[model samples]
Target: MLARIFINRPVLACVFSIVILLLGGISAGLLPVAEYPEVTPPIVRVTAYYPGANALVLADTVAAPIEQQVNGVEKMLYMTSQSNNDGSYTLDVTFAIGTNTNMAQVLVQNRVAIAEPSLPDVVRAIGVTTKKRAADILLAISLDSDVNPATGKPYYDALYMSNFATIQLKDAVSRLEGVGDVFIMGQQDYSMRVWLDPDKLASRNLTVTEVIKVLREQNVQVAAGQVGQPPASRGQDFQYTLSTLGRLIEPKQFDDIVLNTDKNGEITYLKDVSRNTLGAKSEDIMSRLDRRASSGVAVYLLPGANALDTADGIKAKMRELEPRFPPGLKYAIVYDTTPFVRESVHEVQKTLLDAIILVTIVILVFLQDWRSLLLPVIGVLVSLVGTFAVMKVMGFTLNNLTLFGLVLAIGIVVDDAIVVLENIERWMEKGLAAREATMKAMEEITGPIVAITLVLSSVLLPSTALGGLVGQFFRQFAVTISVSMLISAVNAMTMTPALAVLFFRNRKPGKHAEDKEALPWWGFGLLGGLATVWLLTPILGPSLGLTTGEGHGESAPGGLGASLAGLGATLVLAFPGAVGGGVLGWFMVRPVNWTLGFFFRGFNWVFDWATRVYGQIVGWCLRFSAVVLFVYVGLIVLTGFGFSRIPTGFIPMQDKGYLVTNIQLPDSASLERTLEVTDAVEKIALETPGVAHTLCLPG
Candidate 1:
């Protein structure tokens, strides 16, 4: 048929370069070396509290019945609530983009358990907040110490490395494996400060709620209930006994316990009045660069892990626990996203090795021979070693947008081996011999090189049905430029016509009658289609930087002049951005469809019964082409209920960097006058010239 594959061109280029180096070593050992891709977003939060109510009575008793039962869950989008007369209440929410924060946390814990028997049991806890990126923070810590460097330490400490990188390394990187949470600001957690004496509690008539019930029932521990095993005579399995004794470690054990007694067995203690002090609790803390005090650890990277191998195994376990710290405590990890995904996968492997050494020096200065530059550099390394062995058997990873779509398909993967080696050097200058010029150049370009590599691999096959997160980042850059241009059009049809019938025979067709009167067939197909219309006329005519005297002059176009200047700039900029955004959106679509047609004419009789159920889905799309392809796959499975009615986000919060600053003061402000209003807001963030550095954390 195709003239028996060049009658053994070096055993078909050594069995298609050993089956493309065994599928490019199994797609470079199965792809997935990610840093980011599998996204969920659609956030959630909730929270609650209330004890001494206030933020307008805890936002009308616990954030309005938990935001009216999570405002009808699915893709809610905006919720935001917050109250704080120091008796908090939250809300947050934010769904939409394929919302499913684990089924929106079981529909917000069954709509906060149907408004928990109408809340108000002095509401205490609610919490939800997940929207996983393993709950954000893919690594941040940054510590370096030597403290008392004669007590200087001033080197702009990013909020003491963001609160000792989240409370001394986020509870051991939130116990590692795909860590979900580890947020820490600058520093916090160490409290105890009771300074009572109001005239010795008015000569011991004691009150402040009886010194907060003798310091929370002498630092609580209670258990008692359960001491059964003794009545076990017949039916076995009995060991029911639970006992516990209390012990409040220190602060003079709340001035020696015993509270109400006096009926005769008198003993009302607590140093009879009060004074407990032990300090260091809540008020943002994050310290590192030797100023000791630490807390800042943002490790998150779990959903289908691998963010640079979980941030290089958490910086090699923080340099193997930096000698179990203590010598002026230390830790260091400035920031990571694995060095911006290894500098964008080493800048697309230096732009795919400078576009394969500038397309092998412009095909050896325009095929000046050497077997037309070793049969198109062994047919572009056997079509990128069989497109990295089908991206290591479809595991796929060499990221940075699938290695920038395999270095922008290295000149459209050598345009059908430069059009079947310029049509077997025009049939070896017309006298054809080397196996009849490779069987008349594969029967005159085998059906336009298999219909231009199946219409350029069917233009990224609708980006693998792109569902969410921009179809998991352009479905691995459209399956690495559609399987490396379908393995460079099957190595330009069987290893460049079996290495051009064994290394381009005669190979002396360079100046045949001054290159056949300087190229004839419509003057070399109108100078190879006007160098693919001046290499795709700067995306369809404009930048006339046209200097094609060929070779490396005003460089750009290559093989088949970059596939007809990228298919005439993708049909001249996608047919004028889809017919000019559909005719400037039809003259502002009749006053925006009469302002959303008066809220969609109140669902126009349920959209006229969904247009008579899509007119029985266009009469079953022609009396059933498999029931119009199962009603076009039930309208693509009702596009997952129109993508769960759209509105979800976990990251993408851009109210510019961040600054919460609340300052108030009065509640017994001490800690050195609340660190002098946190050193005058860190001197107005070092005199803000577009600030970029600030640290005054205490809340």
Candidate 2:
């Protein structure tokens, strides 16, 4: 009935399909592209630093209090903490998939606040930070220097480069849209150092503690009062504020600070006991690029952000800032994940194209008519492209899983169209007009198409109910295929029947235009046998005492006469076998034809041959119904057994176009020793096959 309405009003059917195409085209542009759907659980990290504290001390003082309070927060799956020997502590709180990272961060921050009072004063003063961040690194930008134009030497040292990235690049990148955070790896901040002389301190009767007390007291802000008072002076025209030296900024100012005065008109200054200079806060870490001093700035992506878009924005921002960089300073995005994502998406797109072409070719071969082929090809395009609209509505991405689903759906989506088209052609061959044939065909297939669509959707839709990362990975894939199938069924019921009516012509009994049924089954078997023998003769001829008379050379018969004789002898031996085998194979296949003709009396020969073979197999099973059912049950049991025995994982390991290597040294190893080990490792890695570059960061 639905097909009849569309068959009468073909314009309405065409309009319906065109609307789907337009919406799908627009949705394809809007949907985010990714290598995979979001499968990583949301994470909130807590970081704190305690200067001069060992790993053991940090574990006892900083980690314990925080973990105790932060554990078992809302939606939390698990939490892990690491206390490093360098007095740094990190706690990662992993929440269940689909949890809002912002809410998870707030909950963790609240817990951390409750533990703050129990922490040591020094650790508390240094401060603890809580923020939501992804565990995966999106990009790693490196800064290095070339020859300086002014001095003909490297423009900046390690400390200057590290601090420059911290001051200039880190905040700029962090403020970019879709960026979660930025970190300056192996960073060193400037601080004034006072190298105290114990001998000078003994001579002055001052201890290290006394000198530290004086420094703290003197190196502070002085809030001096106003110079003019408005309340007392009636004639005062202006109020002047006083300015005084605040915190010391230079080593020279620290050197001149007073420490103590002796008994007889003498004074002690800080310079009397200690030497001071501006230096890095700590020299415990070092970073390098290609054995040159460098600084690394790692950019993190926010949860649910588009990775390709975020990476593009970062690169664009860097290019905009390149001109303002100091002479000889340059930045490179040494490590990026976007290229892999882009290439993978492109590869899937190619596969999808290949699938469409292949499905078209197969339909053309089977239908044997270009006019008939167009219907299924159009159905495939409409079903696949229209699925994108549903994907956008459901918040699905154009990722590997969904694309793979589309590639598989190509074969499936073409089935409904082909079924309707074949049935309509059958009715036309029975002398019915095109419109009447379309109505009759739709009456037969409409129920079967709906049933197939429902069956397929029911099978795939349940995967969406699976829990955790597995569900996230497969949900889009399942839904994409299911939507395509539903669209295909709709097209079969509407556009397919309408197009058939418009494209096909009426045929009278015994006057069909196409001659697809002229060849008999026996003729096909004979030709097939002859072709098989022709192919195998070259290789099996010599083994079967049949040759081309080559080895005899001059002594043997030569020229066309000899070749004809040899060919005649070979045919004489092969003809009888070919004919006998062909006749025997035809007899064996006759039952299949009989079974097919019984069910589909008026269909074309090719369709009948295919359907009859399948029907004969089913007939055989029906004859041995008990044995067939037993075998089927046994196969189901075997499948269950095999599935349970196979090794399983959330996702297979992939070569992501780069590798990460982490090196650790002995607990008591100094930074210099760590650098030595890293240098050796870097050299070995460079010598190994397939390694393009190496970055070493020792801390």
Candidate with the greatest lDDT versus the true structure? 2
lDDT of 2 by residue, 490-580 (tens): 9999998888877775344334654333224454455555565577667776665455333311112222354455556567555756676
Model 2 Cα shift for residue 292 (angstroms): 2.7
Error of 1 at 548 (Å): 34
**Model 2 regions more than 4 Å off:** 1-19, 51-57, 116-127, 147-153, 202-232, 240-243, 260-266, 365-374, 431-436, 498-653
State the lDDT of candidate 1 residue by residue for 361-472, as single tens digits. Answer: 6765455444556667676766766776676555556666777777778788787788888888778778776667777788888788889878877888788787767776
User: What RMSD value applies to candidate 1?
Assistant: 27.4
Computed on alpha carbons, the lDDT of every model, listed in order, comes to 0.61, 0.82
Model 2 per-residue lDDT at 417: 96
The lowest-lDDT stretch of 10 consecutive residues in candidate 2 is: 550-559
